[model samples]
Target: MELTDLRKMRGKQIAVTNGLILTLLTIYFVMISVLDVTFSVLFLILGISILIQAILGFLKSDSTKSFIPIFEQVANYEKQKMGREWNKQRRMGFIWNLILSGLMFMQYYFSRGSTDHVFQIDFTFMFVITLIALGLINISLFLHIRKVDRSTSELDMKGYTWKSSLVAVVVGVVLAVASIAFIMFYILSNL
Candidate 1:
């Protein structure tokens, strides 16, 4: 195959994988919202499903060993494709997050004025912490977009550097930790 054809195949592969995952998530969320399952049962099922998913993800990556350096090449192709669609996606994310955050702040403000201690306690310190952690998520997304924007036509690791890779790893870890902390905080607070 020509070099361009190879790159196009890889890019399409990555896009297909991402699309499938998003489709599954959408289906899962829709099902969960429609079901009236108890919290304990839901949590148990979610935990087990997540564990299975991690194992499957590992196996999939292992099986695709021939597709080495997925990060570098896949990113370059996606970046090239990230034209108006990416801009639209970014704008939608910003608008949705802004509206969600505004609703959260409104809830917190109203809770404080109410005499109900339960609601007030629920939305107090942890809520603020969650909001701050959300900034980390936004930062990670921005970092990804910046990296995509910096993608160059030259392949073979010509554009990416060790420092940038390290920064990406650090940001990813921070986002993961923040996400776990938020989940834990929510569980504990609700209990």
Candidate 2:
């Protein structure tokens, strides 16, 4: 496919994914708000940041200008490298998700003490549903990346940057750390 075609497809995917992410964020915010306002707000900010990044990715120009041809070349090289790495990382993520799902299921099953303290059905249902949604999202992202990798040459001509992936990794790590910290704090406060 042509660069324009690939760009259009990616743009559409980004928009749809961003919309779903926003919806999930809304649900998460509601659930957390019931538990703790502080933790909820922290997650709300993170979700908003993700939404903004997704919007930027979707709106980024695909056209290459003569004035910055060298920059474009560098970006193309980086995208190619990042694409290969991303493919490998995503394969691992898929496997990990499957393992995690199995573990969570087992934990839920084995932790049941009695009917009196039976896991809250609502929480259990939501937990499973959320895990499924996350798994699906990751799978969708993996497929999208695969499609993009197949069309990388076409996209490279348009000056797509692979450095974005590196940046995303750093930002994702920071956000994850912050999320873990917040969860810990929330748990401690409640206890």
Candidate 3:
């Protein structure tokens, strides 16, 4: 086969295998949850299924380009600008969470002897701390988005094709609504 044909074949293989593996995963989770099953020999079936899937994924993704690396390459822009910012922002978020945790702990620890607690205990302090934590999270998220946008300013990395994207979204919404309806019907009928 010509190089072009080989590339096309690989792309098709990748798409098909990717779709199948993900669908299997969705089915596995849904069945496990819906049937109220647990760890057993049946789980071995899930394991083997996933192993086969990984092999198929590796086979299809053997070419120079893979999904994650492509996405990273797009997002990182030059020499990991977005990546560095992401790591830095992630650490900042962790630190903020730790600070929040400590503050909450202190608030609880010091107020252990108080007659009024939680909802009635220092409402202003609780509200202020909660607001600050929320604001920090929002600010960090916005900053990350800004950094990513700045990095990928020039490159138009359209992750999905317009038609397929639309179709996928519509199908997902339909499935979700239908599943909810089915579940409600089942519950109501049982009642």
Candidate 4:
């Protein structure tokens, strides 16, 4: 494929993936609304971010200026480099979605009998598992980007550093511990 064709292909990949995510998020938001559940601010932030991404994805796919910075960088690459990294780029989004689905499945399986709202569905366990899953996903993305950086000369991308990964780990652990402690305090105080 020509360089322009390769860029278009990448743009389409991004658009399709973002579109799927937007659909799923819309479903989730609707479900929570129907159930009268109070959602975290995180969901609002994520929803807005996904909405922006979907719009940017569509623009990129239309061969317009890519609002996403990464795609703009990728556009500078030669067709050969772009082609070589295409498979990895395509797979990364799918793998991330799969991993998240798996985590959600595990959470559902463990909390199956509860008819409670989503928040009370063994959330502490799910929260910790989610933290771990996100960490692993981040590491995987870091490695993928690092590999791509090694081959491409057009982009001077800095992949995730070990220190950043370590910091992420530390923060996740701290959050998990704090959440657990808060849950414990709530239970004990009620008793």
The parts of candidate 3 lying over 4 Å away from their true place are: 1-81, 120-143, 152-191
Candidate ordering by TM-score (highest first): 1, 2, 4, 3
Q: Candidate 2 lDDT (Cα, whole model)? A: 0.50
Backbone clashes in model 2, listed as residue pairs: none
Deviating ranges (above 4 Å) for candidate 4:
1-97, 119-157, 161-163
Predictions: Cα RMSD each:
14.2, 14.4, 17.9, 11.1
Tell me each candidate's TM-score.
Answer: 0.36, 0.35, 0.28, 0.35
List, in order, the clash count of every candidate structure. Answer: 0, 0, 0, 0
Cα lDDT, model 1, residue 51: 49
Query: Once all C-alphas are superposed, what RMSD does model 2 give against the true structure?
Result: 14.4
Task: Tell me the tens digit of each residue's lDDT in model 4 across 138-157.
Answer: 56545544554465442432
> Model 3 over residues 12-110: C-alpha lDDT tens digits?
544554555456645754565456443432333444444454455445432223465533333333224333444333344344444444554555455
- Candidate 1 structure lDDT: 0.51
CA shift at 134, candidate 1, in angstroms? 15
Clashing pairs in 3: none
If both were scored by TM-score, which would come out higher, candidate 1 or candidate 3? Answer: 1
Error of 4 at 101 (Å): 2.5
Estimate the TM-score for candidate 2.
0.35
Off by over 4 Å in 1: 55-62, 65-169, 172-191
